[model samples]
Target chain A: MDSAGVLLDAQGLGRFVPGTQQWLLRDVSLAVRGGDRLAIVGPTGSGKTLLLRSLALLDPIDEGRVLWLSQTISARLVPAFRSQATYLHQRPALIEGTVEDNLRLPFTFRIHAHQDFDRRRVASMLEMVGRGADFLARSWHDLSGGEAQIVALVRALQLNPTVLLLDEPTASLDASTTQTIERLISHWHERTNGKRALIWVTHDRQQSTRVAQRVVQMNAGKLLEGT
Target chain B: MTVDGYIELKAWQVAIAASLVLLNAAISLGLQLGLGRSLVVASMRMVVQLLLIGYVLRWVFQSDSVLTVLALAVIMTIIAGVAAVRRTERRYPGVYWASSVSVLVSSWLVTSFGIAAVLQKADTWYEPQYAIPILGMILGNTLNGISLGLNRLEDELVVHRNLVEMSLTLGATSWEAARGPVRQAVRTGMIPMINSMMVTGIVSLPGMMTGQLLSGVSPLQAVKYQIVIMFLIASGTALGTVGVVLLSFRRLFNRNHQFQSGLLTAAGHK
Candidate 1:
């Protein structure tokens, strides 16, 4: 980690089952600097999801701590940290509403109230993936698997978090859809102009190498260097 | 013991009326309804509880102290809170306080307002006859509402935790993430009351009004009191159920706006 340029860091991070002396993740550490796309690959139950969620500060950590911009993120700052370091899950859970309603959800928060929902921005983002503004009016339940995930991506991008923790976001999608998602992400990344970073968790090695400049492996909760 | 126009039944007569449950228990044994033992035990408990309450109410009536009434009211609220929490079959930290607030705020407000302001029986405002039974009725109904609401809230929150985290990731607060479940819980909690309200006059007569009519009270007077009590129940339940749900949902998230799943003793169970 380049301490000065590091945007997010997890120092000797650990997680244990609620009861008993069992470690789900132990002594795992990671750092994502601005403009870095880090991809973590591992087998099922290898804790890639756990590590990504831990780094995102979504899961409760039993050991060590996370730092936003090298400053340790305490309980008080976790929400603020979460707002900046967002996590996107593989399965999208959209609320019961039109696509536009789902997109407008974040601004309803006190944290995001100052930022108005910009329809044109969202429409333009959709257009990048061959979707039009009419996509906004699509009902949540009626959305295809690819489209829902796309909307979810758009929703997360609208917040413009400094770091994104993508957990198998395209694992279930077709090749075309996966490429569209990747394009959308790199497009968003380019738009940020080296100010943002991303950590992708994928099982696909070639795709991981293609997406991330720095690829790592997580197995049974321990993070290891990729060959 | 004829204090007024109300006809009082003797202890033996009351015992005879209560003995009918023994026959029901026997029929349950014969028909194999699977609740024979439970029926007997529940009936015995009911008898014991009602008899104890009867004697306690006698004492309360004789004393006629507002402090005693208030103390009893507090006890009722505390029990209601505990009972509601228990019904969830899941433990939630600090939910008792939320439930107590809900019960006290709603039941107390409705009961006090009904007797003192609506009925204009300031002389017997806190009296045992006026207060205890009314309090009992409201507490029982609101207890059911709050418990149902709380259980639904917890269940919904747990089942939809992923969605909640999704919103949090999108820069939403804990409240904003859980907005849907909290509202659903409130609505789910008041469902029983709403259903009761819908069928009150047509399907079945309410217990309170029935008791009044059996005691030879005028139909008009009984209906007037019934209407007042029903309105009181509806409003109290709405306010109290909503209050408990909101507070309960608040506790599910901490100061940092993270969903505290540890608060749940069990999840995803009906």
Candidate 2:
């Protein structure tokens, strides 16, 4: 991948809850290249989610700078910044709309609002993720957690984001669905011509080795050296 | 025969007043109890606050001092600020101060413009009978709105953390990530007011209009006043909900673009 793929440069990031002053993430520094597959593993309450949010730019850091294509960016530009990278939530949440609505959500934003959304393209994306084209017309309530997660992933993929942040993307899925999504994600990573990066957070060590090139372990808000 | 000096009370007059009190009580009760303890306490607090305000209004109306009326408005806003702060479960230390300043500033600006300059036919710009009641209504409605917007926004901030992150990573600003949820929060917060508005007159007569009729204002005059009050409520709610939500957004997130966990602690039951 060329310089166009160098998605993020995050340094000296720190986050403290406004009142309790608990350091959810403190002085964490990370640089992500395009196509880098980094899995973040941590104990519960260790700010793994917080770190994902910071990288995704959903939450703001108390100290540090996040640079996108060398522009000084902060919370104000989170949506625009993150659209370049998709973040799959720990718990999949679909909007109170139709299946097609969730799939079309990113395109509705001003950042991606102008992106072309065609039935043919959306159908292919669904099929690639092991879903049928007819699934697009289904009601939001009908989807199981695993189906919702896949749909969320597909929605994020629609933007062709340079980075994908997965927060336990398969935690709720059955073994078969997990394997299916894992395989599909790996295939999509290659098809992007190595133009994209994936940053996944999970507690499952086996899933980490299966899906990630490098595993970064976190505990008590600090990163530990790998085994 | 010579006419008697005493005014005669009509049967319909007593019925209207009784219904007004009952309806107000029921609506207030529904909001307080159905929504949870915060709303209930809020209703009680509103009663005590308005009653004290009634006494203050008497004093202000009897006097002609502009400063006293202005001071009274300021005091009302301060109370509103306290309510906004206390309403949130995970309130920051400076929340009260922020809410107070925002409410007071917005209310003063809106009320002064709406009444003094636009509705300039009043005897005095600071007339307590007119200005105080209007100000109280505006401040009271805005307080509820800001509280709802803040509480709902905090909830979204937690629940939609990843959606926000996804947006942020994609080159969205923090405000952009939070924008959808913020807009949702404000819209949801406005629902109760909007629902009441939709059902007004059809479901039940509103309180202020009923009060005016019982006090001997002509039905036409009371209806006109009710129309004006409804517009003001909508206007104040929009201004207050938007202003508070926007201002608080800066504090709600960190420099790193994470929603502050402390906000969750401050938010009371949904």
Candidate 3:
């Protein structure tokens, strides 16, 4: 990894539920460079999701500092930092709207309204994800699980985020759909010129090996190996 | 019979009406027995609360003092707020206070405006009969609505938290992330009042109309009062529910826009 490619650096992070001594993610540290494809492998309830949430700045860390580009983006800037780093949920949460509406959702926000709204780009993105022109107008309920996941990924990609935190993006899909999605992700990475880094949280070891340039294994909230 | 004199009804008539009221209570009891613990608690609360309210109303109306009536209304607002917060999550500290203010302000506006300006032509108005019952109906509806809104919003925060997080990551503000669920919750919360509004006169005669008729008012006058009361109740509920939910959102989230665990109770706990 390039020295200047330290897009995300986290240290000494701990999160605890009140009235419980058990820390969800304790004493964890990780650094990722641009072009780094990192897979966070862990079993269920092993804090892989928690770590991803912390990295995405979706959850406030009890004790930690996350450095992004030589600046500490603390809890105060979590929302702003998170906006630049897409966090795709384990299950794609499709809103009650068409595929096009989902893709264009970010621009609806006042903070992101100034970003260029390109319909052609969205159509092309959807096409690359194995969707057709009619998909944009299709309601959310119409999409299968795999299709919904792809749409969600495309929506995140449309924001032109610097990093992607994927929580088992293909966990619920069939083998064929998973392979298709994998190809789409590869295509997206290439298209973005590798300016983006990915932190994929997954339980499938093979899937991790397939995408990870660097791998970290977590067990019960601690980074056990493969840093 | 003198027009201003209190006409004491025969013992049998009073007993029959009391029995009818008891019959309604027994029906409520049956519903409570069927639903189990929460409904039972709610029924018990309703019984105790109404009895207390009865005594309180008697005192206020007999005194006919503005201060006493206003004080009683304030108490009702406070209770409504407490109920809203408790129904959501008792662990959310400082939310109840804000809920109270919202409930008070919204209900006060509706009742005062409806009674003083719309119903009665009084310049400086404080009539316990009009104000107190209106206040009770408004507070009760708002209390139920606020409870629904708060409960739904909190559940959304817990269950669909990922969607909220996703929105935040997608550059949506805290309010923007919460807005969809809030709107859905508020809309859902208003449904009971909406249904009540829809079937006000058709399905059953509401209590206010029945009470007015018992008090020797004409059927037309009673109907008009019920209509006004229903409209005001719906208005109060919607306004108060919106106000409390919006205000409670501030307390539910931290400066970082993340929901604090303290505000959440474990599922199956409530």
Candidate 4:
């Protein structure tokens, strides 16, 4: 009953294509604690993204439920849960607008309507990734891949979620861009004073060693202790 | 000389029907469009359908029962809804109900306004002569608008699934996530109405206006009828497209506002 210590708890989660018997992920269990920077490394088709998606409650699970801060998340409470523990895909989904337009989007939701769109705050967050205030006004079409990822990260980070689920957020970017994302996420976690957490699904072994406080490996839908 | 509420086509002039068949035959033969069989079949079917519709309308006009008018309107709504649903690129379990409710509601609201509020020359608002034709035109336009919206709903979801999910992850409700695509569908659905209005009377005469003119109504009176009907159509289409798209998008999510993609038909078909 007292899972207050756990930020997120994924218990024996499973997923399968609905009309077929084959399971894409099964018997997967993981728990994220506050300030834990956990990295998940695995082969290309090893279900890392599937596992992260399930943990974020983005995908419907066939066999298990997710508990956010010891409270079981029912279907009715998913949006709230997702708001607190958000998932970022490998490729950021941007609309046809300026970066400021996208950043202001979250406040449009009724749940977040109490919050106002803080342009000054966004400008500072942009500064963390070496982008200026004018970066917020840049068109979505004009942003390079690195700039897009930074925008996506800022978009999620500005929400001030308690947990961040990163699905190879820098999978294809060069080293500098990867470093920017890593540093931005690290600073975000560090500032929480061990009150926030992150889980990154990555294929790069070296990046995992450098960024993750503790690393886990997955193979064929099963989670394994990192060798 | 009068024929079917008109004085232009004399009974002896019915021979023009034979001339149309020959002209179509010449078009099919000369262009090698292979349209001969289709043209013949379509013309014959048109003759039968129109003749039957004429008799039905005559009976409806003779009657004064509100129930009879409603029954006919309900039947037409069902047919129009089914046609709209069939126009979708992807087949889903809910498009039938979604489109039907949309077309019925929009058509009913607009038709009631036309018959009861605008075109109130009949003894009662339920008079079949006024009610039937007004409801028919509104229903026809509403059906097309909604069908186009339904098709766009399926297409946009498949194409923009990622962006939609991104919105969901940001704490947006289902309605918020789909607002973009639904608006796009509604606009796409309304394009035909907008295009027709843009060129009405300038480039071509509309069906109802032309019919009124040929029936010996003064040009000014016919133009007035066309104007009223055009506004009715615009209202019906705008309402129908919004209704159908909103209904279609609502089913795309669950009570939790989580996007359940299973509501969509399998991809690769669109």
Candidate 5:
């Protein structure tokens, strides 16, 4: 792939047990371009989560660099980088307050200070997933697992991030809710009109094929392409 | 050596007061509380420690040298710093240094201000009578605040690891991600001092005021000294709690706005 279309590029990323020689992720390199859909499938304990976290700069890596827009990201620009490239955890984490509060949290950060929370925008997104405007007023604690994941998805999508690193975002949800999440993510990618990328890690091979255009397999801390 | 109209207790009289621990031990044994041995041991340790400190203070006072007073103050501050982090259930690397620096800076600054600016009657800035007690009181209270703050911070970070990381992943600055835990920790640390302040002069008599009253100082004079001590302690505890909490925040998060949860290990974990 040429560098022109690549939005996120990882070169030989590795993570190891601190103060030990045990490697958790080794020599993994991947390129994500705008409008690209990639799925990473792996068994439990195969370091897929670690790989995704490393790409997002959520976890420290023992080796290699991640470049954004063809330039290595600097420490000062990490927040800016994160704002454009967001990570979604398998389990949703919402702050104490209403669902709207959790959705509005990102705007409270200095990095997003220039942005304002758009309730109408969020309400419309909720409507896409069969949720009403009242869903936005629901308390965070009242949200079911699937509902929380929807909130997490809407929150990230509303930010208009260029890249989304999803770590099995619908792992525990039911079939229909999982489909809804997948559809929501697909819509998010398509809405950007080939301007956004997705790196999804999932256990379901069918879901991988359904949501992603390219499939990669991770086994024993190594990335195998064209699985 | 006793001042006129001020009664001095004899050695036997103090021994009689010391015997009160035996009564406590007897009650513990009768109740099968399993605290009899600990009660006796603690009382014995307190007696020895207090007696040794009494002799040390007397010697330093007689020497009347600035170095002696300052050296004792530094030693006390170091001990207080160590004691502050000793009981925490969780700790990160450099926690000792963080706690110690917080304790040393807050207590020393407040004590110096008290001696040099507030209580200006001392012949020298390092007057043992004024400086030692002031430092001790401030250090004691500030130690509690630092430890409480540190413990609460660790607990919040650990329990809410996902929440904190979620915020960071959403592009929060280190301060923004940690603002909630920091606020809670600082409040936890300051609560005791605030409670004491709320109850002062109403619910219970404070130690320094009681000491002054027993030493034949006028009630109004004792009250004034107690007020100064209370204010100094309040500032010291606030500063120390905030300092330690902020320092731990820096240690727990990096310049990249990542929450380094790995750095924080629970107590007794390798």
Candidate 6:
């Protein structure tokens, strides 16, 4: 990826177990450029989720810094930065509401106060995943695992975020649903016209190879390039 | 001696009241409940503590000094604040300070208002007869509210860590992300007061009103005092619960909208 196209960059980022010398993520540096598809694969305790969280600036970093478009992020810009770089959890958490309420949640936030929730935009996005607009009215408890993940994806994608940090989003889903998610993500990336990027953390090597153009490995709180 | 139509209890009469605790211990022994020792120890502690407080209150009332009354009130508040955080299952490093400040500010504010405004018949705002009892009642109720609020806040945050973080990653400010837990905590804190208010008169006579009646106060005057005390307790509890919850929110989350779940350790865990 070209340096000028870099959207999210981490420089020697490190996170330790609060007061102990034990490192949870150490000396991890990564550069995510526009339209880049990167996957981080590691063992269960290898800190892949921590690395992704660090990149998203969701966790406190004991050392190093994360930059947005080559500029170091300040506290004031964190909300805006998060709006543009959304993090997706492995187990989707929907509020106690219908899917439409979940989709409208982001607009309720102060950071997104100026934005309006466009029903037509969300409906068309749902259509891409082969779901009808009627699906939005489904209660959160009624959604199947695959369907909940779809709502989560549509919720994040509707915000038009520049970078998506996904942490094993399909780790528990079946193969068919996983492919659908992969297709939906690729379609979203394609629609961004090379101005969007995604960092997918997964355990399945075949899935990584299928979705990511470049794959990195994590082990013992350290990042290794090229898998 | 009988004074003002109120019967005074003799030392032997008070001992008769103390002896009832032995019956509780006897029942514990009979049932093999393993609470005999605890029951005896708890009753003894209560007797000793109340006696000591009785003496201290007597001395303060005799002294008639504003400093002594205010000092005692402060001591009661600090103890109440510490006791409030003691029952929480999850706590952070600053939980005690947060609880204490919440209890102190809310109880004092409401008590001061009661003394300076509602009970203006008192010779002084810091009159020991008026201030100490009012502050103590407010502190007791405010302590309960702060404890419940702080406990519920930590519980919700810990249990719903994922949901809270999900909101944060969606670009929510800390206040926005924590709205659910905050609301729940405040509600939980206020519930006890609300329930008591609902049943205050019809269900049972409250302790203060009952005490006033036994002390030979007229029924109507006692009812008025009870009403004021109830309102004071309610406001104190509400203010304290909200103050502690808001303070905890500031401690648990930072300006960057990050939920520092790591800061919360299970109570008694290293």
DockQ of each: 0.58, 0.38, 0.54, 0.62, 0.83, 0.79
**Clash count list over all predictions:** 0, 48, 0, 0, 0, 0
- Prediction 6 global C-alpha lDDT: 0.91
lDDT (Cα) of model 1: 0.86
Predicted structure 4, TM vs. truth: 0.89
> Clashes in model 1: which pairs?
none
For model 3 chain B, give the 10-residue run with minimal summed lDDT: B1-10
lDDT of 3 by residue, A87-204 (tens): 8887888778888788877787766777876888878877776678888898999999998988888888777778888899999899988888788677666666777788888889
Cα lDDT of model 2 by residue, A1-227, tens digit: 24454668777888887546888788887777867888888788888888887776665467787778767764456656667766778677677788898776666567776777777877887787678978998888999888887877777776777777788989878999898788768877887676777888999999988898999998888776554
TM-score per model over all chains: 0.86, 0.76, 0.82, 0.89, 0.98, 0.96
For lDDT, candidate 2 versus 4, the one ahead is 4
Candidate 6 stretches greater than 4 Å from native = A1-3, B22-34, B121-123
TM-score of 5: 0.98
For candidate 5, write residues B197-242 as lDDT tens digits: 9999999999999999989899999999999999999999999999
Q: For every candidate, how close is chain A to the native chain A in TM-score? A: 0.97, 0.91, 0.92, 0.96, 0.98, 0.97
Model 3 residue B109 CA deviation in Å: 3.2
lDDT of 5 at B156: 95
- Model 5: residues with Cα > 4 Å off, grouped in runs: B1-5, B121-123
Best by TM-score: 5
Native-referenced Cα lDDT, model 4? 0.86
Tens digit of per-residue lDDT, candidate 4, span B1-270: 677667765545766765768987998899998998898898889878988988888888888788888888999999999999887767766778988899899999998888777877545878887889998999899999998888887788889999998988777777888888888898899999999999999999999999888887889999999999999999999999999888777777667676777767753353
Best by DockQ: 5
Clashing pairs in 5: none
Candidate 1: tens digits of C-alpha lDDT, residues B174-255: 7778888888899998999989999997999899999888777999999988998998888888888998998887788876
- Model 1 chain B is weakest, by summed lDDT over 10 consecutive residues, at B261-270
